[model samples]
Every structure is written in structure tokens, then in C-alpha cells.
Target: MTDLLWPGDARAGDLFTDASVVEAMVRVESAWLAAGGHPSELSTAFSVRDVAVAAEGGGNPVIPFLELLRSRNPEVAEHLHTGLTSQDVLDTALVLQLRDTAAFVARNLDRQVAALARLAERHRGTRMAARTLTQHAIPTTFGLKAANWLHGVLDARDALSAAADLPIQIGGAAGSLAAPTALAGSPAAALERVAATAGILGLPARPPWHTARAPFTRIGDAFVTCTDAWGKIANDVLLSSRPEVGELSEAPAEGRGGSSAMPNKHNPVLAVLIRRAALAAPPLGATMHAAAAGAIDERPDGSWHVEWATLRTLARRTAVAADQTAELLEGLRVDIERMAATLTAARPGIDAERRKMGDDGPYLGASDELIDAALARAQGKPC
Candidate 1:
């Protein structure tokens, strides 16, 4: 819940707040009523702390939450939460929040990709030493490096987008819409109403996901992939900006990347933060994956709770990492002189690789063409 490290997603945090969650549940209830299955109205003045205090004892907040709402307006109690279970409300609310969160993440990813494209086009022919297995092995261009970064980001973004189309949960108690079938005639009709509600909420409509946790699992995996892509960029920045090999540096900014004891220390703070997010994501993802197996009955013990926290944190960290990577690339400084100087030290290694291929010089095969192809593909144009 403490998003101090990954702070670009303030809205994402707000979406999961006690009041916002209560509101989302009400929204779900309202959508159900609007489908003509029931009639109800929810009060926005419901006390959030009351539900929070009740849920503190390790049960779903929806129970006490509905109690408070019905007490406030007893007339609408029958229609409100009439057929839905705790997980139904919680899962639907989660998907609603995730849909909005995905929009912000998508924007950041697009900007990051565009920034990398520009960097690649600007330095298409700026030669640099390409390292493999932590050793210089071949001659390449900064453009190629940027292009590779762009490709990784594009792939991760695509994966994340696909995962973001989350399926909504509407199966009533025990993973069957039986409780609600009295109102909608059959389970299929109730699912139709659920799909309609999801359409309004901007979510993918499917049968009950009570026991099926793949939606959250895929989301966690996609975010982990995004963090990995950004981490690759960060790792390269950290290595290239080292004092001994100062080929790349973060743009100098006042009061940024300052050291506590070292006077002349200007670190790659953005990259470091991104790397931290990348490092933090996989463990959270592991928790989600593990939680999936624990989703035993219609309502398991603690697996869903694990998913709520883990998925939100993963999305927040990934969003922050994407935002930081874009900002880093926007003002990223590339020292052509330093890059050229490193090439001299890397000549022997490069020559060894070149001799193995019987090549005489820098064989930057199709790097420029790659940059052009990436740009064209980004622009939705034929390459």
C-alpha cells in the first residue's frame, strides 16, 4: 500500500482506497439494477472506516459494507448485493481499477517507445562497443542499442496490454449464478447482464472467475515482463555511465542523484530506481503465481488477498518504471567521444570476433535499417 518507491501511479493507489472500493462495489450493484434484474440506489455517504474496521478481523469487507448500506437505506437492501458474493464485488471492482490503470501505463509505454525511436534515429551511425557476457565482443551503434530497447519495450507493452483486458467475475455464491437465476431466468441470461455491466465498466466479461485466477496471473506476468525490459535499459545505462566507461550519462539536473558523503557523486538515480522495481516485481509475481494454486474452493483462505496487494503493487511499480525510463531517455546524454574512446580499448576483442567471421571492420549489419523498420512499424506504416 506504501507506494513511496513507485509514485507515478497516484490514481492507481486511489482506485484501491477504502472509499473508492466501496464506491466501486456500489457501482457494480447499480449496474446490476440497471439491467432490469432489480431496483436499488446506493448512498455515497456510506462510512468507509466502519467497513475497514470490520474487515480488519480478516474477512471480506463486502459483508460489513453491505450491512452499513442496508442500514442506511433499508428499502434498497433487497436489490443491493442481492445475488453477488464477496469475491464477485471485489473482483469486478479490481478489474474496473485495473482498466483505468492500464490506460496510464499504456500512455507511458508509448512515450518511452517514441523516445527510444528518436534516440535511435539521432545516433544511427554513432559507433560503440557492444558487450556480450559482460565483455566487449563486437562493434555496434548506439542506434542499435536504442532499437533493441524499443523492441523490448514494444513487446512488453503488447503483452501487458493483452493481459490488461481483464475478465470480470459475476458468478454468485459457490461459483454458480443460482442465487441470481431467479431474477434472470438462467445462468446464461445472468451472464449476459454481467457482460453488459462489464461493457459499461470497460472490462472483459466472462463466467465466474472465482476459482480461475488466470486474469490476475497474466497481469502479474505482463508487468514483470515490462519491468524486465526497463531493467535492461537501466542496466545498460548503469554500465555505460560508469566513470571508467562514461559513454552515457543521465542529464544533469539540480538536486538530482546527489550523494550523502561523496561531493562529486551524480548517480543514475532513475535507472537505479527502475532496477529496484524490476528486482521487486518477480517476487510479487511469484506470490501471485503461488496464490493461484491456493485458490481452492469457491472462496479460498488467503490467496485472493495475496492477489489484490500483489497485482496492485506490480502495476504501480511497472507504471513508475515505464514513466522513469521515458524521462531518462528524454534527457539521456550520449558521449560520442567517450563511446569512440571505448572502441579503442575494445578493438582487440572486436577484432577477435571479426577474425572468427573473416570480417575486416565494423560489421554493423542492418542497424540503420532496423531503426527505420522500428520507426515505420511504430507509425503504423509499411516498412
Candidate 2:
């Protein structure tokens, strides 16, 4: 079966490669080639296409490529990557991918947030009994749940915005852009220009981070931020849809999930899928963190590489999860009758307790007050 996610899109594949990274490497190499002058010029002296092809196979091809560059044109090789190292290219590429992914996530989040806000307004006074640990807790307007979900999504959005400013690694051989510095005015200036290029491409600038993997770690955290909120909504849907609870359920639909023996089962398939993806996100975040920790100065000791697959998998999967969550929220089926029934069943106990205390029972005390305060604040009214 064809993969529901990713499929075979060029842009998706390019998230890991594409021309941006290649062009950056080429520009660095060309500068070195020009330093040699005319016949000794490095541009005509090396083949990036050849190097790229060799790098494609992975295991230690970079060393051989450098060897070839040095043998054929020693002067050009002298300036080739300059003080830069492979981690520079790889890390920068990862940041670029993250920046692009962040953009996509941001747009989708905006849409989902708007949709949820509308839902909240529509259900502002729709009363329901809130539950804690699967037991009746207190009365709450369904709008409050929507508002809580919105707050979480907004938090994730803020996290992504912050992560977008993380710096890209570009220090050469030993966490210093020394060689490029020697050829192109100053190493610091070269790094600045590299950072400018990265920023232009939507990545943040940072000091040389050859061994430091904090940037990637931050990006991983942002991804988790989004996934966690999405997971909460999914978990709520699953819990609310229980036959015993039945206050909410997936929109009635055909072909969601089925039982072969019992023809009456309509499963919350999307909710289940989203929950599964949410469960997968924390481990993926940990994998990225471990990879970042494993990076050595100017080189990765396979720790960074270890996270490559997991990061990519998580990125693609989370995108799918986000899309699914949005759809689920947009089309959710809330049963007013069921909500009333559940609340009615719990009202007697609540009323008895309230009578016993006279004024201090489980009356959702400040909840309604808080909601009224929020509404008043939104309307520019006095608190």
C-alpha cells in the first residue's frame, strides 16, 4: 500500500537535501577555488556533483572526496571547506529543514486555533459535567474545555516561534571558521555571512556550535510542544467517547473502523491513531536529545546521525498527527443529551454536598467567576 504520509514529494525529500545546502557548500568551495587564481582557481578545479554523488553513499565518503580534491588540485583543496567540517553542512541542513517544517506547522496551527475558537464560542454555554481521573468532578461549560485546549495550542505556537531563532552550526575544522576567515577577510565575517544566508533561508544564527547540539534539541522540544497539545485533545476524545461516558464521539462516518463479527461498531480510528502518534513523540524527542549530546567538536560520533532517522520520522509523523487532530476537532460530535444525562446523574450528589456546606461545597466556585472575568476583560469591561 502507498504510504498515507509523505508519498514521494520532491519538496518533502528536499527537506533533508534540496539545493540550499548544496549551494551553500558550493559557494564555500568556490571562494576557496577563486583564492588560487585563474588556472589554479578552485571552481574549475573541483566537481561538486562528483562529491555529492560520493557523499550519497554515506560511510566515510567525505574523507575520500577530500583526498581526491587534494590530489587533483592542492591549492583549491587548501581552501576547499576551509576551517569548516562536514558537521557544519549537516547541521545547517538540519536547521533549514526544521525552519521549513516550523513554517508549515505554524500555518496549520493558525487555522486549527481559529477553528477551535469558533467552536468554543458556539459552545460557550453548553453545560457539561467535568471529570477528573474518569470520575465526575464538577460542572463546566464545554466552552471551557475548548478554551483550555486553545491555551495549550497557543503555548505550542509560542514555543515554535522561539525555536525558530536557534542558531545554525558553521564553525570549520575546530569550531572556528579559520580557513574561510583567512581567505574571505575574517573568519568571524565569513560566519556572519553564512549566518545571514541561513537567516535568509529562515534559520536562526548562532555562534560556532560544532559540538553543541542545543539548537537541534530546542527544535525537538518545539515539535514536542505541538504534539503534546494535539495528544491532549486526542486523549480527551477517546475518553469522552467511551460507551459509559458517551458525552462526545467522533462524527458519524463510514469506513472509519469496523468489526467483522459485530456490525454495530464505529471506532474512533483517528483518535486512536493520534493517541498512538502522541505516545511516539516523547521517545522521538529523547532520541534527538541523545543525538545532540553525542556530537563532538567538528565531528559527530554517530550520536547526531543516530537521531537523523528518528527526527525525520517524527517530523513527518507529527505533521500527520497535527493534520489529523485538526480534522478531528473540526468535525467532533458532541452529544448534548448525553452531556445533560451525565450531569443530571451527578447533580443530586453535588446538590446534597452543597447543602451540607451551605456556601463552600464543590460548586465550581471561581470557575464561573473566572469565565465571566475573562469575558468581561475581552469586552473591555470592568473585572
Candidate 3:
């Protein structure tokens, strides 16, 4: 029966095709073929065997024919999978994809952090008015603000890298590897072999987590953290680019924005896109968590299935957003003169306070000390 309600096709360029995912599939397929498993069982377990093995075979082959295909072109389904369930391949594939996605995001985040660090250093002492609760509060440096953003991005990058190390599921039927145990040694040995295979593929080596889904949930949480940082940066850019503020501007580049009415407008469309991407993260995370939480015993009926789609979607969206965010940050523009003017306009009240203080030193109380402390911390120096 053809399923008309199936989601659109996933292209080869999708983030799901990350190297980790490819390596994982290769590992599973290798294990299956090494265990002398029949292609029929494998086809039953992985419904997309044709799609997975089409490069080595012609059309859709029957179970018995698949074995012949496997033998004739052993390389066709080389290391094909055996003794594992669908969840093993699917879950492991997810972890692999996440690992690659995390790496991609980390690279971009590092670039943004370094760029912001330079911007912060350049504007370190350039004073600007600080706002709190939507009202002007005190004087602060534009560089300090950029430094704060860099710190947040750096923290998120570390978190994402840590979360990528979560284990993948590899247990067989009933999450006990009973079938593989009957064929090979004990279930423990079977699981160890699976873990070793996963390690060979660069995935984290750990016991099957068919029922325990903290790993998957953690990946989603990490993505949320990254998106939140990106969204905050975007929000700042949008606010600073406003006509009234005019303290910052998007770089004058092609493909920035479009308008039907306004001829002299350079909207912060990239900032808006960043916000949209951040907004999309929570629902994806919620769906993943709900799927994990609904797991019943060793195998939650459709929980893992639900998780697969969301995980893939999350990876693709995150990669796109990360790439776009890096580009946006790299080309961001700041007007130091405008910033100074804005600050000077707001300094009359602060000057009044300073005048009231008589000769009690500088008006910036502890701010310089705090900045020094922060800078020291960032540079790995003790306060």
C-alpha cells in the first residue's frame, strides 16, 4: 500500500547525510554481513534496503535473491547488518548525524566568537549607554557588550560538543540481544561487538540505549542552547539597526533584503531569520522529548519512529541556521561614532550623579574591575 501522507523526500544534501551517519550505516551493515545473516531479515528490519543498497544492486530483489546479490557482490552490502533491530540502525544513525552537526556548529561558533572578540577589543573603551528594563541605566563599552556575546557563544559551543558524546542504541529484539546471544556468545559480548563497531565508525561507545533516551534528549537541548545564543545576537542587531537607534547596521551586501514599498530600507532580514530559526527549535525539542518520555519498556511502539523524523529535521535546520549565523556575524557593522553620540546624549544625568559625589574618584564604580575580571577569565588568567 502506497502511503500518500508520507513526508517529502530527504535529499542527498540533507544534514542526515553527515559523515557520521554514513559511517554508522556502514558499521551496522558490516556487522550483519559478518554474522552470516540473510538479506531477507535485513530487508524486513530496514525497510529501505533497496535505497540503502541500490548502488550495488539493480532493482528490488527478493529475500533469497538478496543473499545471492550479497554473495556475488559481497561488497554490495558489505558489512551489512545482522543481529540488530531497526532502532539500532536508526538511533545510531541519529547519533552520528548529531555528532557531525555539532562539529559543524562548533566550527561556525568559534569563527563568530573570534570575530566578536576582535570587535570587542577594538571597542573596549568606547563608552555606550546601557539599557535595563527598556530604560537607560548606565554607561558601558560597546566592546564589553560584544565580549559578553562572545562569552555566551563560547559557552554554548562547549555545551554542544559535550552533548555530542551521547551513546547510540544497538541492542537487538526486546533490548536484550536475545537473538544475537543465541547465535553468538552472551548478550554482553554481542553488545560489546556492536559498541566496538560503532566506535570504529567514530560514534560514542556505550551500551544500547533503546529505552534510555537521555542521549537523544540532550542533543536537542544542546541545539536549543546554540539557537538561543544566535537568537539573542540577532535580536540585538535588529534593535540596534532601528531608525531611532542607528548605532549598528547590517553590512551592505547583496541578498540582504527586499521590499515592495520601501525603496530606501535595509531591513535586518538575517536577524529576523535567526529569530525564526530559534523559535523553531523548541517545538522540535519538545517532540523529541515527548517521544523519549513515552518509551515503554525495551521498545516503545512508535516512540523511536517519531524521534527519527524530528531528529533529522533538527539536524538540517540547525546546520542551515549555524551557517547563516556565522555569515551574519562576520559581516555585521557597528558605528562607533554613532554609539559615542548616543552615549554622550545619555550622560547628562550620570554626570549629575558624578557631580554629587564631589571628589570620590571615577563615576564608573567597580565596572572597570568587573571588566578586568571578565577579560582575565576569558584569557584564562586568574582574577
Per-candidate TM-scores read 0.92, 0.77, 0.81
Better of 1 and 2 by lDDT: 1
Model 1: runs farther than 4 Å from truth? 1-15, 37-41, 381-383
lDDT of 1 by residue, 1-383 (tens): 44554544453456455666678888877777766555556676667887889986647777888788778867777777877888898888877777766777788889988899899899999999888898887889999899889888888888887898887788888887887787788867777787887776666777787878888889888889888999999999999999999999999878888899998999889889888888999999999889989988777778888787676677667777777888898889999999998898876767786788887656887887988988786776877
Q: Per-residue lDDT tens digits of candidate 2, residues 228-266?
A: 998898899899898988978877666666878888888
When sorted by lDDT, best at the front, the candidate numbers are 1, 3, 2
CA lDDT of each prediction against the hidden true structure = 0.81, 0.68, 0.69
Q: After superposition, which runs of candidate 2 have C-alpha atoms over 4 Å from their true positions?
A: 1-83, 199-202, 252-254, 259-262, 359-364, 368-383
**lDDT score, residue 150, model 2?**
74
lDDT by residue (tens digit), candidate 3, 1-383: 11133211221144675333544555555545543433322332333444446523532222333454355454446435456666776676667677777887788877887677677777777777787787777777777788778777877787797788867566777787776677567766676676666555666667668888999898898888888888888888889999999887777777567677888878887787777778988899999899888999888877766787688777666766677678788888888888889878886775665677674554556555555555665566786
Q: Give the TM-score of candidate 1.
A: 0.92
Task: Name the weakest run of 10 consecutive residues (lDDT summed) in model 2.
Answer: 35-44
Predicted candidate 1, C-alpha RMSD:
2.3
